[model samples]
Target: MNRNPHGEIEEIEEEYNYVDAPAWTVDKVAAPQDQRSLFFTQSFPLIAVCWLILLVIMGLRIHFTSESNAKLTAENQQLEILMHLNSTLLAAHENLGRYCNNLTVQFDLLTQNCTVLESKIKDLTAVNQQLTADVQNLTTRSLQLETQRNNLTKQIQNMETNWNKLNVSRAQWSIDAYCPRENNARLCKACQEGWRLNQSTCYVVHDAVSTSGHKTWEEAREVCRRESSDFVIVHNQEEQYALNYYSWFSTLTTGYWIGLRAEGWRWKWIDGSDLTVSHWTPQLPPAADGQCVMSVQNVGWRSVSCAEKKRWICKKKALYV
Candidate 1:
């Protein structure tokens, strides 16, 4: 032990010397717990600690990435559903537009048909009114024509009555050339409506007859009414005037028979006329057998037996006027 100057003890190392040998290595395997190994023994614990921290961080990242992938798949399915719904809505709108167009065209045709029917009804009403007016006019004209026809018939009947009054003779009378009668020259035909013109006298025989098929005087008159329009009658004294120039018969001895009869001196004409005058010779109607006669001397009536043989003077008329 050695001490310093301040009285401390001092120790001393003995001098030992080691010798350098030649290099020779032994073949040996290293063990895991060898602390003195120079290649990896000191850093083994640090490497294990670092590998455990990296495992922890990698586990956390794997969990987060799995969650993100599931969320993305759900969003893609939702977008596809929305696209299908939009396409269906667009197709429905196009179908509805086509149906509305068809309905509008049908409504226009119905309106046009109604207007044509109204015009046809107006034309038919006008034609019906015109026909009614024409029918009324024709009925009024027919009534007026009937009234005029009735008035004309009355005038014609009056003229016929005046003309017939001059055709029948009552007695023998003579007139000179002053008055011209109707027919005296020619023998008249059956229905001599006009007379034969001559110098002094004008006469006509419209018809003459010797009647029979009679039972009584009254029945004979009725039968004559069916066959002739006028009964036997005489008109005036001068109507019995003889035809002088161109007579049909030529016997100057006897006068013609006029329609005259007597009942108890109550003188009557055959057509029921009053005895206004007479052309009787002296001593007429002496007895009951001398009541009727035929003209004998072309002068006047004379009494004779009713059965005497003499030609009866037939004429167009036999009734006294």
Candidate 2:
């Protein structure tokens, strides 16, 4: 069957015509009709459904991408802030290290100062100890000196008492004896019994005649020696005056032997004293060898024979009061 341009169906006649033609001549035939099925019309609804699902999936993918981008931007800002904070912390750490170093230096200096102070303290303590020891020694020495002073004071007091007593006894003796005023008061004496007090000496004038016939000069000298005395040696005018006074009072007209004698033409006393002063008579008696000196009443010294009998004066140390 064939369809025309006009919406009508037509049938073809089945006629065979034989033609006389050449050997290559053949009959012309029409192509067979297409019978393929329509695939677009049958799958239209399924394609629409698949397209809707793909649209939904694409929208969901866009939303997820936007969310991930926002999260990444926030994370970047946080990282920048952390970096700045880290830089500030590093700077603070460096400053802290410098301060720590300064503190360490100060501590070392303080330690050195403390050591010096301790050394000074030790020296001061030693000096103080030495001073204390010196003070103690001084105190001990002072005490010893004080004790010695007390003992000396006591001894001096006792000596003063004894001296006072002695002075009193001396004054009483002087009053009783009526010591001569012509002699130096300091040198006067109070003689023993039967002795006459003179200047620092005691004299014994022997008036009694000797039992061995009137004594000679040698015999008088012997008698004075037995009494622990010696013949009087008159050296001055005062002594001569005293003798004269005694002779006048005793009424002695004869001479008395003295200790003077001539030796090698020079006069000397028996006690080795030089005769510097003399009371010789204006007309000295003719001196003879072995002649001694004598003092006569109303006359000065005269040389006499050693064998002549005469009175004698003996002199000795004065007795202590």
Candidate 3:
């Protein structure tokens, strides 16, 4: 069919040329093979609405999954952190045990050192006690020595006093020698012969008798006076030697009397001359013998009774220089 360009009610060109007797019928409608694309084309608005709903649903699901995953990851991280903390705690516990052991060892060493120090202190104390004892002993010894020294000083002083007394006596005797006798080994032969003399006297000696005969003291004194009118008196050693040379002294007894007597523990001649010349035994005047005098004869002196009679001795002092 030919259609006018711009006429109303013109016949439309048919796309498929239905040749032969093919004509469009109301009962036979043409249908597409794939109805999805046709439906998308015809129902665009409806498809758009369905697409939006699907997108919203998928977005919701994605959101829920992501939230679940995040929760699990956070839980896992917390567990891992707890495990690390446990491991760190175990390491710290081991270190603390080791430190405790080291401290114990140090404490033991300190205790031992303290014990040694205490022992040293005890030893020092002992030494101090010994030193104190030594000092006390030394002090005691010094005191004793000082006491002895004082005693020695007193003794020496006493001896000096005795020595001075003896010296005084010797001085007085030396002055009594007016006419010193000649030295003849303690013998004065010239003085005995009336040639050399002291004062205004000469020595006249009786003979010595070696015979023994007991005689009373009064009888012997009387005989001595009768033998020489001037009376026999001893002058020097030479006169004694002359009497001995003449055998006038008796040897039977150790002692003989001249003119000596103890008148109340004192002896003096009848002329008041001190009887200083003594040749008698020690302690001659017997305490209970009633004897008051002693005589030294040829041997030794002995105490004699006043009533015995024996050979007597005497000396004569001639008044001639």
Candidate 4:
């Protein structure tokens, strides 16, 4: 050993530096044990410090790895939750869309039904109006029918009363005209002398053989009254035709007086009854109060002045067996 200028001890190295040097010689040239022990003691501190720094670096790496693994696990959990929520939201959205479609279809159907119902309502309204009008017309017709029935019933009653009165008058006239005054037992004859029997009455058509045979209407009626008879009364078409056959016409002015006369514009019988029928010539007379009806042969009756001299016919009810 030698001391350098820095006052540190330096050891001289043996020169056996061959790769294949003998092991015995190398050992023989080695430093003493005390010297090696002193060298190891100084180097031990440096080795311990290096091992401590390595251990600290390994611990820091383990801590950073664990922290990164935890963060990745948390991120995976968050991703899974977000995916589930997105799936649920998609399903909800699909369901909502289908529901809206269904609602739209139903709304359209309801609108169509409303339109059809409105048309039906309009048709029903028209039918109701027609029915109302028909009901009103039926009511009016029923009222008219009821009034007509009432009027017919009244006319039937009047006709029945008049028929009864006529029957009574006929019986009285028969007794007066056919029974003789001198016979107390009231022996009746069919007709008096010079009187012709028709149906139920006796008639006498006095012929005007010349103008002297004709008499005024009042004079002819007076003569008939003296014989218990009156001027002829035509009651029907048959009676009127019989009177026409019985009458004589010598000229246009020659006619026989009858029991009809004009009271106003209407003709009436001498018994104060209205004329129910008439047979007049084509040239009718002007309506006047004093005009009397005269019968012509093969022609109809004519209206003439009551004072005119014309032949007359008398009539009385015939006696029955």
Candidate 5:
């Protein structure tokens, strides 16, 4: 038996020849048909129940498969979005790295420039210091030169004044002293006819040829004063030596009266200065009131009484031409 597409059951009949059979075979066939019919009747409800259980299992499988396909599609779309975001982030990072590199280069250049400027400033400072020192040295030198110039100017002024006075003195001396002597007419020498010139001074030695020519120290000094001079004043070693050389000696005891004399127990010159230097003889006696100084040839000075008679020397400034 079969079910058609229209939902109706149909049976196919087989053409069989009728033949006589023995009773036992017939009984055997009939019993088998009854048993098969009983078995179909008993299993029909259980077969329906099994078919229902199988249909339910197939429907659940199809539903679970559809849900799994939807979940897989959503996961693929999310993965694509994540890949796009990663690409954009990579591009931004690259740009930032390039900008950082440029900034670093600019910073390095600025640092180098600053270093060069600092070196230049230091060099300028050193040059300035050297210039300042040079200026100070120049200032000091200039001040010293100024002081020297001032001193030289004063000296020149003094010399000019002295020269003028000397000219006036010379003119007066030429009229008063040189013009009156007939032997020295038209021949103006440094000394007069009877005087001897030693450097800038004129000296005259009066030696006594007779006893009348000899004079006491006071008398000798008065004679020099009348001649417009004074007794020979030994102011230095050279003058002393010259006097010793010029004085004529007839005996070892002979000495000339000088201008030095004792005043109030101290030796004084005719110029009123105290005796700071002396050429006294080794045997000179102690000085007292009325003691006077005299010079001996090849010897030294001696203290003698003012009343003693002796030769004398006179000294006066020479006339300038």
Candidate 6:
């Protein structure tokens, strides 16, 4: 055994040397049992504190998860309500669109009807204007017709008055010129009033201005018979010459109606005398049926309708008044 200084006992020994060890090597060495037990005791409190903090964190996570779930549910419900409202609004918009379209169609139809009515009104107005013009023209024509009728009435009245005056003049002349002789006899050589002495025959000429003077061929023959006379007959060229001379004094363009007519295919006198000689104008055309002879001025003779009016000459034997 070896003892160091401070000890009383001393013993002589052999010399021995010691070397220094590294710190890492010394720490690697296992510690004593008592030191290990004391180290565990100190670390126990730190481990307990870490466990408490972990538990607190887990509790906070659970609380936050519950709140997030509740908020998500509420948001989902709200979103569903919004989707339903959008659907309802879309349906209403569609209905309004249809209603507006119907209104547009109705308005278009009304516009067309109004246009047709306007066209009809214009046509009616034009027709009314034409009718008014036609009425005016008819009124003017009626007035013209009325004026013509009045003028014709006045002419008829004037002709009737002239005829009445001529008849009165003839009556006065007959009353003033004829006179009866003694023994109710008149001179045979002297002609009656209004007669001219012509080779033992009394001849009278009807005035053209008198109403009873102008007569058709048939009417002239009847008038001569009423006066106890007959139409002038020309037995020879001398008598025709005398008759032609007498026609020169007439105031008529158409001289007189002779009692000569176309009968059976030849000209004949009304007294059944044969017409052997004719005083026709040069190149006289053939006569037609119902045609009578008329002495025309400067033209000898012409065939005319029996209805034509002309002056005539009558001859009779001289009679006393």
Error of 4 at 249 (Å): 4.6
What lDDT tens digits, residue by residue, belong to model 2 across residues 251-290? Answer: 2335778888877766778988868777777665544568
State in Å the error of residue 53, model 3.
10
What is the clash count of model 2?
0
Q: Which ten residues in a row are the worst by lDDT in model 5?
A: 9-18
Cα lDDT tens digits, model 3, 44-140, are: 7776777888888889888987887898888788878988888888888888889889889999999999999899989989988988998898899
Clashes of each: 10, 0, 19, 0, 0, 0
Q: Least accurate stretch of 10 residues (summed lDDT) in model 4?
A: 7-16
RMSD of 5: 16.5
Let me know the TM-score candidate 5 reaches against the reference structure: 0.44
Against the unseen true structure, what C-alpha lDDT does each candidate score?
A: 0.44, 0.70, 0.54, 0.80, 0.79, 0.71
lDDT of 4 at 300: 81
Off by over 4 Å in 1: 1-78, 121-321
Q: TM-score each candidate.
A: 0.26, 0.38, 0.30, 0.41, 0.44, 0.40
Candidate 4 lDDT, 197-246, residue by residue in tens: 88888889888678898899999999999877899887788788778778
Off by over 4 Å in 2: 1-189, 209-213, 248-253
Ranking by lDDT: 4, 5, 6, 2, 3, 1
Worst 10 residues of 3 by lDDT: 9-18
Which has the higher TM-score value, candidate number 1 or candidate number 5?
5
Order candidates by TM-score, high to low: 5, 4, 6, 2, 3, 1
The candidate scoring highest on lDDT is 4
lDDT by residue (159-221, candidate 1, tens digit) is 667555533321111121212244764332322244343333233332222323212233333
Q: Model 2: how far is 202 from its true place, Å?
A: 1.0
CA shift at 21, candidate 3, in angstroms? 27
lDDT of 4 at 303: 84
Q: What local lDDT does model 4 show for residue 16? A: 26
